[model samples]
Target chain A: MPDTTTQPLVRVIAAKKDYPLGHRIVQALRGVTLDIASHSFVVMQGPSGSGKTTLLNLIGGIDQPTAGSVFVAGQDTSKLGDSELSRFRAQRLGFVFQNFNLIPVLSAAENIEYPLRLNKVPAPEARARALAMLASMGLSEEAHQRPAELSGGQCQRVAVGRALVTRPDLVIADEPTANLDSATGAKIIELMREMRDRLGTTFLISTHDPQVAALAERMLMMRDGLLCDA
Target chain B: MTSWSLAFRNVWRNTRRSSATMIAIALSCAGLMLFGGYIYWAHLAAEIHTVVLSGHLQVFKSGFKAKGSGNPAAYALANYDEIKKLLLADPVLGPKIDLVTGQLMVNGIITSAEQQTSSTFAGVGAFPDEIERVIYWNPYGLTEARQIPANKHLFARKPELDAADPEGITIGEGLARLLEVSGDSRASLELTALTPAGGLPNMLSATVRQTSIRAMEEIDNHLVVMPITMANDLVFPGEPMHVTAVQLLLKHTEDLHTVEQRIDELAREHQLDIEHRSGWDLNPNHERSLNMLDMFFAFSFCIVGVVLVFTIYNTMMMSIVERTREIGAMRTMGVTRHGIVTMFLQESVVLGLFGGLAGVVTGLVAAWCINHSMILYTPPYFNVKAKLELMCLHSPMIIVGSFFSSFTVAMIGAYIPARHASRMEIAEALRH
Candidate 1:
């Protein structure tokens, strides 16, 4: 038996995914197995349509595997229903998107406070924690600005703040810097490293940017829907 | 931020689109309210006209309505005073009754001496003060009082009839015209009729005091108003007074059925074989008109509902399509499908509340403006032109119904799109 005391935070065993395209089934993920330890910063590098986003979606509980199983925080996500998966995502996982998907209507601080509010945190405490998170991102002066009012780097920081505000056990980022300039991309990558180090949260990122890949503690390469050894 | 606050802000994202949808809802609500208010006012006006033309309930001898038309005096109630006293003393009915009076009918020919013109006439004899109360003292006051045309004011004003003018009579304007009697001229006319017992012709003379415009165009050509005592003396000289029927006016028409029941019980106790008829029973044409008006109101309401539903549905569907990515993001941030639906519904509710409230306010203001305006038009079967008035604020049900219907329909419109949004696959939604 494997050691339970030092068991990985995420365990994927021979996971596979297939999507129906019109009249045919397209394989998005081939049989893949991986283990990510706690507090590890891992990056999966791939070109377009190489199944990196699909893998990130499976790990984040946004999609279920067509076969095999995915275990996150000791719960088998493949067996969970849609509603249970949603709750699991809320309590144990967070996501950062390529386009910095901060709710356009909410202020920067309010967007960060949203997940905490969903978790039933008291209003004042949620507000204070959102402010603290914003300050930590060096965005205290832009707390009251909406996504439309902020620059791309500022918006990405707010998105990062929102993902980490709930202190989830795992954070998944899909092409986080694809929409940003090189300078902004480097800064966002630096912020994510600092956050992972300080909060001891596991980070799983899918990217084609070498600057992002250079910061990964465990780097995996994917091509043709299969992960190859580094 | 709270879901409600988020929803509130989201609605304003597309200012022009949201405002247009809200305006559609507001207009629908106001249109329904105004049409409903007009129908209500028409109902009240028609009811009052019927009651004043014929009292709320009329008591007749057992066979009067069916058999008395051919020989009215023979089927007339002989103990008229006794029946009036019994009606006035009824414990359950007395307080509800506003006025009770006896009437006598005289069918005769009127001859204008100076003009040398003769015409057939149907005449009613009533108590002067009681007729005044029935015609003028409506519960709705000035709004109802204005329903009586200027030419008919004599029926509701001074000198409708009096002892000093025991022989004074009011005739319809068409009848006066047939007799060649103008408003400026004073004239005397001779009435000839057949007595009940002798079947012999009898004649009496009366001074033409006033001319009125009653409801029906045909009635206006042959109607005469006189005193009951004069009618009795002309029909049965020196005999005890007799009347065709006793008419009752009530404080409220809603109590007609209850009052009719009590009157029937009283008639039974007194051992009188009598039948009672309500205003609606006597005025079938008025009731038919009211039914058509009710149909018009229902048709208008359905139209408003359909248009409003489609408007709100289109608005919400477009909004959902535009925010597809944002919805996916929220789902990714741990908002449940139910949460997404709730947020959209909350936005719809806010729209409905604001739109419905604006509609009610606009409807009330429009009603006031119409009531105060001098818009006039002649209605079918009416002898005089009537004022156009809408009674919106007086009807609480219409106001509440308008708001509730708009709000409910708006929610229904939002629900379809919200459900669609909630069931969307996150991956496809993100791609959108």
Candidate 2:
């Protein structure tokens, strides 16, 4: 496909994260290493506490590991301070979740524009971008509706629109289809895959759903916080 | 796209919680403001009393205030014409003096034909024309001068007093009531006081000409206003001299500060003893009222602070817990701990702003309603009657202070929650 070889957008190396659970330390991740190609649709699958979500978090730079390094777009996430990392997240990353965490008070259009606003994007431009994203997601008529007014599928659709509206370098989706029914779940995966194919936007999703795994071009299976198969 | 928009959204998300918090803040501020306004009004009223009744600066004999006894006419300025001419000629002090009048405080027993009130009265013999100039200082002068509604008619100019009749007196309505007399018609009243001549005590009989009201009932009820000539005749008999203190009224009361200093300098230059007293100093109750108000304001501020902290704390705690997964997702999406903190803080400030704005409107309206409706105030040690006052209407400080306090309290309340939000671990947060 059109000379699709490019530098990796995310690089994880020997990442380790430990959490204190009462008396014993729980190792959430243990020395996992991998490189995600630019614009690749990657899926990570594991049971609860298997570090699939942890891997996603490390890649996203939301949490720092006890030991290890994560680089997104060649910038080491561990080296950035809290504020800088936040700016990096706003400027370069987007996220989607199974719960479709749309702010309850904001309408669809406002939800999509939230990140842009946080990044201090000019109001008119942010509005135009949000409206365009809403229309693209078949939510043009529902722009003013809040999350409570939308159905599961519509909320998820709006969530996806919000995640991609900023046109970030990477999109992190953690069990995005877990809350939806099979049919609605499939539609969400289809929409995500469409975005990957059309916009060349890279996606890294953590899930145990076979339906979601089937749609990923690159599948990563994890066991006990370690990568078992790729 | 600004952080404020997000904060605004958060504010609207929990309407009940926000409204409760807002009301608490607004009511506290409004209460403080209204009470503060009352104290201010009382203080102002007292000041008007002092300035209008007593004058800003009084020129007296060297030891007149301390030892002149009740006969201030004893220390009457000898070079009266020269001093008046000098004062009237000074460019700096001339225009600043709104009204320059002379007052002669004398002790006399007011007696009416049918009723004999053998109580001590201070005969405030004043120059009719010049006294009106100085009368600018007294707001309740005419009102308290006479309590009987019908006696209000007596404040009108009396031809007898203006004609330099030696027997003309304008007694307080309370004094008139005490003397068992009325202000409208002429009546013979016996004025008995020691004459300043040779420090001998003398008695004179004067006709009741006019009357006035004053808040200080004692001063009004016993006051006998005789012509300077007549007062001089009865006290200093046949002496071409009169005046206890040279009263100086100012155009603007606030200009007292400037004029007070200038007058002191003038008094020093003329080798005269002129003591300056502000309206506040003369009314001890005004100072006490101000102190009590300040204490109330401080107490209210503390209450507002506590309420704000709790309010923001509750909201942020709930938000942090409810959005655990979202926060985790956001963190994974490259949002840092600081970003999380800022996001939550922004939400708090927004909440504060919205609530504060609502509170300002509510407070102003409530204050207006309360003021217009007429609250009853029955201060002790006085007549048993409810007084009506619009405490908040005329004072601008209360309005502005209340507004700023709300916003500040909101910001203060957001601080801890925002810090806690920033400290969350993305991995742990997501798991929850």
Candidate 3:
């Protein structure tokens, strides 16, 4: 449902992923082809084990397609070495996980500042930017709190702030509000849409929640490792 | 936050495990330091014993060691005065020599008139003042040497051969017991020995001054100390004085090899027919003992190293396993494998530094406690019971060496686990 006339921020051509499970090859993704345009709010909706997570992983460069290419921000991710892909991810990509995977040892502000620090931003600027992101998320009161000390919604907001602090070209969120309550989940989706509109950053979110999928500007559904037109 | 601060925080995440690993490293380091301190104490004790008993170097006429045990007078150096003057006049060797004294060895039979007891005696005649200097030179300030017990005050009271008591002799404790002479009893003895001409036996009347427990327990029965003037008079009667060997003491034992080489050159220049020997040459058992201690230290060090490596390895492996999800998150955020490896290594460095410092403090306290304890034991071939002393060499080399050894082993232990964590699959680790 993406506008094919515009240049794509991510291009997947016949991508396939397989897993070896006890003498059987389980296909996680089979011949998935799609193009996501720049600055678009794209949502991937699928049930458990429907290959939506696999597709998101391929786009984020955290994994490689077994049979085809995944191009993100103009670089073919499958051709990059481990270290190069890591640097590529650091410079051009940001990821938000379903579990709100904040580093338990670091505080809210420190967690947000980490990706900026990875991109070689100076410490003072990184700190100021992290504070700004916390204030934007209404998390200024919880900036010094560790992940364990924060509520689930607060932890998820910190994770989202961390993903956007680097000002990356593409942000990938895999069920970013999975652990939050309905009210908290609706608020997170509103906050993310506000962030996308203000920063003009492209977002690719994968989830089974209809609330998350309903807010998508272009939504794609997957079933049995195959994408379906919506 | 910086990588270092993150690593430091991570180290304390599992408080109990980190402490256990640190304790293992600390104990190993302390054990090595304590054993090294003990070995250092033994070296000093043996050095003092050898140098104090025999001079730093001894000079004898050629063939004296091999054949002069029988009939020492035949190989005696009649030019004792000339050799002494020449040694004192040489600018190169004179300043290094602390003292040069002569000794005349005599084998004779002693008869106590009071007890009517006869015993074989091996006699050494020496200058009273010079002998006192050799015996009382306490450079290391040893407690035992500084305070001689009353019962063993024979050498402490009158180490010198008195010229006034012309025939005065210091007899061994065993010899005095055989004669049944108490410490307060004044007894007269007659000494008889073969004349230098190998003719009839010559006799000298003497009085016992004091009894001593000589160098070894076995030698106490046959030891006798007399004045060189009296021994010469009894041996040569009308001939000039002669001494079997000239003993040379140096200002420092480290100067032995240098002085020996110079002495060799001096002997070559003067055309003197003399052979020189060092203190270690006379006491090879001390060297052998030190070598054995060195081997023991090496064996202990290997054991400690192996145990410490495994302890640190197990700790780091657990840390890696516990933080699998965190590692995956960090990798997703663009942290390179090298960066992850470096972070873990930074944690290891902190742990090693803290453990090494604690070990040094603990070792020092233990050494101090052992040193203050007045434990006593008689070593092999020693007549007196020596006080056990532990002296930690306050050398920076030892402390720094121990610290770095523990630190390096810790780093090596962390290296493998860190690499494995860095190379982990991000997707799999996230699931974990």
Candidate 4:
């Protein structure tokens, strides 16, 4: 088995992200520091307005911190330009979403191959990687079908396949099972954990669901933009 | 496998929007292409007409254009051969020349043998072969009329100065009608001109060989062309041949301004008192017609732009409204604000390309159909009837220009929606 106590791949140093919500200045992240170690599944759990998704975004380098730093695998993403951050994301980060944001026009297989294309990966390699990822999701048969042609659970499977196809160091999932039924959600959680076990990759999730929170190796509980419990 | 494929596929997802936008683009492209094609054809046609009627440039005696009628014989090129050699010997201008012919204008009276009526006409003296080359006066020239033997017979006879052949002379179609003259195989007319010899005006007579009408109504109604050798014998008598004007054909029609400037310098240097006129200067009405065509094209382009903006804007707004949650999901999935911008821009480009292609097909088909249907038209200013001619050129420029325009319009329409999508908070998006 892989060592579960490996060094952290992502380190947040008192990160702060604020927004102007009408006349009030909303603090999405308030000097919150966190570490997401390699080969560990981490969950950020909170109710609405808890900044769980904002924390995930900061660590993934999709959004910059207002006052502090988000470092991924030793690189401070806050210092990178827009194009550089995108390249970094393509190389090191994978993302899965609650609504399974598979591009509706593309086939399930194409959705999985999108990031690979953006990275200008060779076609043969991209195709092989997409096929293997689809097989792992048990969606190889529906590879050519569009997202609209698939059910909610099937669409999420494609989204997961998409996230994993890049084979990135970190996977950030924002309520990946929020759109599925209980049984489908459970199966999805199992699939994620199974991938983690096989690949020895880190998974970070932001969710309010108790079931998802329970499956994490560690959970960070947030309330009103502050880390209440770890 | 390519980014292009991704962009293309996204455009078709909303079929209604895609088709609507595409149709809009296609209509705009077709409008521009067809109108542009017509303008191109008109410009070419006008250029040909100018060359056929007036040659490339005309040289007149210093006072001939101002007051030639008072003493027509006095204002003439005394050394015709020297001027002709100067025009034909220039290295750059020689190869482009077809003729350096001379013409002498005079007031004349015509009377057909078949009738007793007589009408005034304008007589033009020219070199038969050279004038034929410049005017291309054969029946095979432009229109689809059967080859007439009149120009051929005129070419063969090479009529010279002869007072006895008064029954043989060429009259303009309109002038022939006014004089009631028949250009029948056996029939002919009489022509008499008032020429000057030794500074004294004298009467001269010649025969009308054939009747003809080119595009110029004024020239056709009154022109009476005769050989330069014959015209000189009648007008100058014992003296040398004198030409009122020297018509020059340049190597390239587009080089008229340069040649005119050169001619001006040469005239000044050589102490030759003369004035040079380009073909366009002699035809102001043709220039006005071309300007009107340009205005029509400009108006059509404005219409196309307005239609395209509205079409693309409607499609993009609908797409943004439909894909609200999807945009949010992409944000949470680590798609940055710029990525969202790129994605939307890519979609717009795809739509523009596809729409432009469809528009090209649609426009070309409409234009081809219109062209083939023999759509005869008489514009407000023109007296002659002409068929609508659309020559699309099928060049890389038209295709690329049309496609770019369509794509740009789509981008403009999508700008606001894409901006709105990019601004969606990841937290708010994930909640939905």
Candidate 5:
């Protein structure tokens, strides 16, 4: 329902985000505009402190824009209340963190199943789907391993499976491979691109890794707080 | 995984902290239950003690309390037998009445000729069989102090009057000392009473039958108890018997109010001029002591509850801090703020349930041990040492109330921290 053959999966219009750093205000995003089309792998690449993470957060519906509107999966996320936004995210969007923030208490499979549970999927079906996603991530053997027991690359794979398990319309990853070595980071980026191709879901990832940026279907550059190429 | 299952797993994530918090909860709950058991035991002790001393209710001629002390002979009930019969046969009161008997209050001058001693006596004349029932009214079957070695002498059974020895008498230990008499010595004594109608004196001969201890020192110094017929013969001699008060002992203390109301109705219906006093009214000290104990228990419970809340709060706050990034991740997965709060509260309720159950078990065991240990304690203003006991088994409320209170305290303790965790901005939390 979200892929309007002519419309992009995500549309951000001159979005501005500011933070209060002590007494002075730091503007993280300055009138940034972008569109992420359905089934495309888009990378917002910038140097450290260039506001890529902030832009990704706004498009993820996890944070409200300081100004301008963010439309994801055909809904203006800025206008939604906290609870309404949470439901919208559960139904339409997925997120992957820079540090691979898998729940340390849950096993890899359980962590994948968590989002489906939030979506009110029946337990038996959620479990089956989570196991299938785990197999797809090439982590069938690590299904019962907690995040602490998994290597950095394996944990990121599990994280990717969890984000994609719900079959959401948009998967937003903020520096998903930042914590890995260059070689491992390339592999994670490869796995994500493969998942995107297999599922036909749009992905908007923020990263400074050129190896990851090299494989993006479309690459946008950022300088200071605004996108250099629109 | 369900929310509850995740919450359950999260609790054991830090086993040491969870154990410490549960221990605090368990100890507080046990303390409450134990003290509650003690209070329960005290209630039974006070109840039986009051009933043994004065019975459940007493009916006296109207105005007797105000004027009878000066001239009790003039205020004595003239129709004692009719009232006792009416109480025993009344449909409402018949089953509840354990014993209906009369007591005659008489005072006289007594002389011990051999000791060359003379003293005033304040005496009670009661039917022996009924008096014995009141002396031994142990409905709860609490351990009798008479069986305790240290208390055997003080709580020694009040000697029942011998029917054949109508001239027999029972005097207090202090009175016996003052008159230089002893039950073993069988000292003969004389009593002189003045008739109410005339100043004419009537003399009676009596023998010291038994010497017993009374609870209060002043009362022990002037007490005397004898058969009602002997008292009537000495005070009225050839007149129909008159009783100062009619004592009614009930099978259950709870029925005292119902029986008193029925007595009032009986008095009105029969045109009898009478007033009544319940056991609590007659023994005010016991009621006041129990009331003070209740206040102390409430105060102790509040302190326990407050301390427990803080202990759990500190633990919850620490957990929230450690899990900040994980919480943000969960929110990013579309877990709502309400879901976060529910998860934490579920964890706390689980902690409380386990802790409360452990406390109940420990308390019940401790109570059983103490009940069987036979530890003795001397009560306030009493020389005899009675057994210290707790009553948890017979009172389920002690266990249930302590458990629920601890559970509620645990819930409240988690509320503040859980709310703070839920209110955390998802972006800031992810950064942390």
Candidate 6:
């Protein structure tokens, strides 16, 4: 067993989020608490407007809770300044979105190399790592192709490769497979599970697909700004 | 991908927009360059014209500028040959001097006996070959005043005062008109002046050799140019050679100030009462006109620069709006706000380089065409027309400055938009 397995990669405690919408306050999360163990695959399933994304954003350090603290990779995310938060996210957290979010101007391999470049990695090493990641993803032949040239499944795979190429402590994937078809989405989920198993990197995914949820080691649910057991 | 390569690629993401932005940059650069070239032409025109009329520097007896017009005889420097020898042998000025000559300015009554007309006249007496060099000093190959066909008679190529014809005189067209005498070789005239020592009357006679126009109408109406021997004999009768002013033409006009300083030192050493004027100082109107043009150039550059700034700003803003989501992705990947701004500024640098290069090439080509076309223009106070030419090649700073201005304007325009893009809420930008 990995030494990090004993400690959780993420901790959320009584996080409360509220914002004024026009004239009224909308509570997106209310005193929610959670933990995600290192090297574990976790999933949060919720319907639209059920605050799953809001909670994920809180854990991602992109949004702060109104009355709580969240820790990721051993640092209190809410206490970090904007630049520090950016660095924290860049070094410790990875994100996979529903839209794939590939830079259209860059090729598949270049897209995978983007995060490494951000981490101040040298160009030759970054390219080597990106190419290695592409081979591991079984898309080496399509390395030079742009995101537009790739199918929906290949783009999601490239996004996943990009997320894991930096080998961060945790990958926060919100609807990573939403844009792909069922078979493609299943392959993408399988790819992520394989990455987690091989690299010992923790994953916190949000999904509505029960099939994807069935493969998670731990499952949580959110509705009306509160969390519940699956 | 490296940030620079990424930025370069992003600059071309919207080809049409990028091209349009670059075109705006290029047009502004070319326009500024052309205008600067014209200003360069004006500078040269003023310098050469001043040199042609007065040499690079003229040394006058002290107080001549204040009172010499009323009594030039009193202000005339005595022992002209000695002063000329001293000027030619001086350590500081000897090597720099291209030509050293003396002129006698005399005013008296002139009579055209055959025409039965007489008029008060202002006369200049000078060495034929040396004064000819001063009048035809076109170092920059400016349109020669005498060479213009329309000015052929006005600026007759032959020496104005010939040594062979000791009694010959060249008179201004206005003066000849007043005397009712053409530039006929047979036109006879007599001049009368007072001897300096006792105010005794003295007279000399000459035949009209040519009639030419002067730049200033007031001077042209009563002007006479004759050999120095006749002038000295007419004004001082039995005295040695005396000169109202010594004209010094230098090999390089840039040496005028230094030579003037040395002349001042020489004056003090010899205890000679002398004052000097540069070609630039002699032509006040030309200096004022150039100053006005300089002001216009400054105003033009500001207006053009501001417009270019807004143009680049608008272009950058549009690109940023289109790439909001992309910015969010990079931010999430740990790109700092400074990093994001750097990327966009790099794009502007590319725009500046390519656009500036294209603009310089276009400006040069356009300037060459205009210079070759031989377009004609008559400047203010000039009776002869000159070729309208742009001196772009002759002035390199204008090229570099125009290019740099475009680059700087593009950067200024991109800065605000780049900063705005960097400040976008990461999650919100992702949502967009």
Q: Hey, what RMSD does candidate 4 come out at?
A: 5.2
Which candidate, 1 or 4, has the higher lDDT? 1
lDDT of 2 by residue, A1-230 (tens): 11224547888889998888999999989889888998899999988889887788888877788898888888898898777888888888888887787877778998898788767888898999999999988999999999999999999999998889888889999899999999999999999999988888899998878999998899998889898886
Candidate 6, pairs of clashing residues? none
Return the lDDT, model 1, position B227: 90
lDDT of 5 by residue, B309-411 (tens): 9999999999999999999999999989998899899999888988898888888898889989999987764445678888877788999998999999999
The DockQ of predicted model 3 stands at 0.76
All models: lDDT? 0.85, 0.73, 0.83, 0.73, 0.87, 0.88
* CAPRI verdict (incorrect, acceptable, medium, high) for model 6: medium
Report model 6's TM-score to 2 decimal places. Answer: 0.93
Best by lDDT: 6
Residue range B131-174, candidate 4, lDDT tens digits: 76676532222321112222333222333223444334555666
Write down the worst ten-residue block by lDDT for model 5 chain B: B153-162
Model 4 score (lDDT): 0.73
The Cα error of candidate 6 at residue B19, in Å, is 1.3
Tens digit of lDDT per residue, candidate 6, span B1-432? Answer: 667788889889899999988999998899999999999998988888888777798889999988987878889988678878989999889999999999899998999888899999999988876778887777787666566665676765567878888888899888998999988665989998766778877888989888876655676788898888888989877788889989988988888888999999999999888898887887788899899999999999999899989989999999999889889888888888998899999999988888899999999999999988878777876656667778887867999999999999999999999999999988789889
Q: Residue A225 of model 6: what lDDT?
A: 91
Over 4 Å off in model 2, which ranges? A1-8, A117-144, B1-6, B108-117, B130-166, B173-187, B209-213, B217-222, B272-285, B308-386, B391-395, B428-432
Ten contiguous residues with the weakest lDDT in model 6 chain B: B142-151
Q: Give the runs in model 5 whose Cα sits over 4 Å from its true position.
A: A1-6, B108-121, B177-183, B189-195, B199-203, B214-218
Interface RMSD of each: 0.9, 2.7, 0.9, 3.0, 0.8, 1.0
DockQ, model 6, C-alpha based = 0.75
TM-score of chain A of each: 0.97, 0.96, 0.96, 0.95, 0.95, 0.96
DockQ of each: 0.72, 0.47, 0.76, 0.30, 0.78, 0.75
- The residue-level lDDT of candidate 6 at B68 comes to 89
Per-model TM-score, in order, reads 0.94, 0.85, 0.90, 0.82, 0.94, 0.93
Candidate number with the higher lDDT (5 or 6): 6
TM-score (chain B only), all candidates: 0.94, 0.84, 0.89, 0.83, 0.93, 0.93
